[model samples]
Target: MATIKVGVPSEGDTLDSPVADRFGRAPKFIVVEVDTDTGEIVSYQAVDNPGYTAGSGAGVKAAQKLGELGVKVYAGPTPGPNAYAALNYLGIKVVTVTGVSVREAVKAALKELGS
Candidate 1:
């Protein structure tokens, strides 16, 4: 079984209110790690959204950075075409979900990916 990494956009207090600012002054990413075989969470962490603007290079760059960190699946609000393509090129899978907490979304991805 392969391990998969997942990332979620940060909602200051919850998933409804996503932080609008870039990861620069307002870093907002919650990354999670899961074991594909057992559907168990291996790790959970928060990363600074380095210089990424929503709907811009920031999302693509962030996805690439996450790929470097070994994340294989990214579940968040829908991403831009550039970011989606870039992530897909990196062999990362992008998913979309609504109204779910970051952690719950990660778990769902783990199960869906069969990681």
Candidate 2:
């Protein structure tokens, strides 16, 4: 079945984790695979952000990590300019979403991506 993976930068490591205030330095990324045809969540993972403690270029590192993780769309606060450029180059669609849990953010991302 067709599916889309949406990622949300989060403060914690769970579906209920709150959305992180910052994207590049978020501690974790909650990624969910949702079936495009049914909109049912197929699977999910909470990946530790490799760029969380980077001294510099954190946004670019985070973008690279997300791309490596196969995140088709991102749901969180806007990233920095460098990160934005990287994400755009990777063709990872981004949608602004905050004040919500990871699960909620995934839903929003799917909607924003029209999946």
Candidate 3:
């Protein structure tokens, strides 16, 4: 099965961490490895968002960070326009979600990404 990595905006570095409502300003991102055929999470990592404290261009910064981590999909609340554009430029798929936790968001994202 193919594996896809999903980056979910999160409040903390855990699967149960609450899903952050703001993409660019999120404290961290829960990077999840999902199995495409089964649509299950195989592993995950949490990376602090450098853009959380940025005064400007946070969206672009956050997008670049995720891209650097090799995240193929972004699973979170709607991102700002600039972030969306940057993600698009990086060929990252964006999935809008209202899930409460990072784990939940990952599942939702996998579904949306056709995994």
Candidate 4:
């Protein structure tokens, strides 16, 4: 099986660059990390939005990208159904958190998954 993976939202709030607003639409996505048995974040990357808005399947596209990267688990909040379905189809587990920092959420997810 592929190594387990995790993704979290970026620190920046806006997805668009000052100049890119004209060149292309803004992107929004979470930061991703890959790991081995240690459960430590090994590889990290940002999954940018594919289109102008999150409504344009950017989230799903991001999920697909994560799948391609062999991500097996994602930690986030209240992901939409489409995103959830995409992750499920990709064999990635989704762990949802409410009102918690990304770090805490990850720890909680790890605990819950017994990883």
lDDT of 1 by residue, 1-115 (tens): 5666776766553434453323222356666767767767777777766634445467677776777777777776676677778878998787775466677777666667654
Maximum-TM-score candidate: 2
Off by over 4 Å in 2: none
Candidate 4 residue-wise lDDT, 1-115, digit = tens: 2355565443333212111211012243444453546666554555554534545775577677667766676665555677678888888887765455555555667776885
**Can you rank all candidates by lDDT, best first?**
3, 2, 1, 4
Lowest lDDT block of 10, candidate 2: 106-115
> Is candidate 3 or 4 superior in TM-score?
3
Which is better, 2 or 4, measured by TM-score?
Answer: 2
lDDT, candidate 3, residue 86? 97
Q: TM per model? A: 0.74, 0.95, 0.94, 0.64
- Cα RMSD for candidates in order: 4.2, 1.2, 1.3, 6.9
Instruction: Write one digit per residue (lDDT tens) for candidate 2, span 1-115.
Output: 9988888899998889999999899999888898989889999999989889999999999999999999889999999999999999999998999899998888887786674
Q: Per-residue CA lDDT of candidate 3, range 6-92, in tens?
A: 999998999999999899999999999988888878999999998899999998999999999999999899999999999999999
Query: Residue 31, candidate 2: how far off, in angstroms?
Result: 1.3
Worst 10 residues of 1 by lDDT: 17-26
**Candidate 4 collision pairs:** 8-31
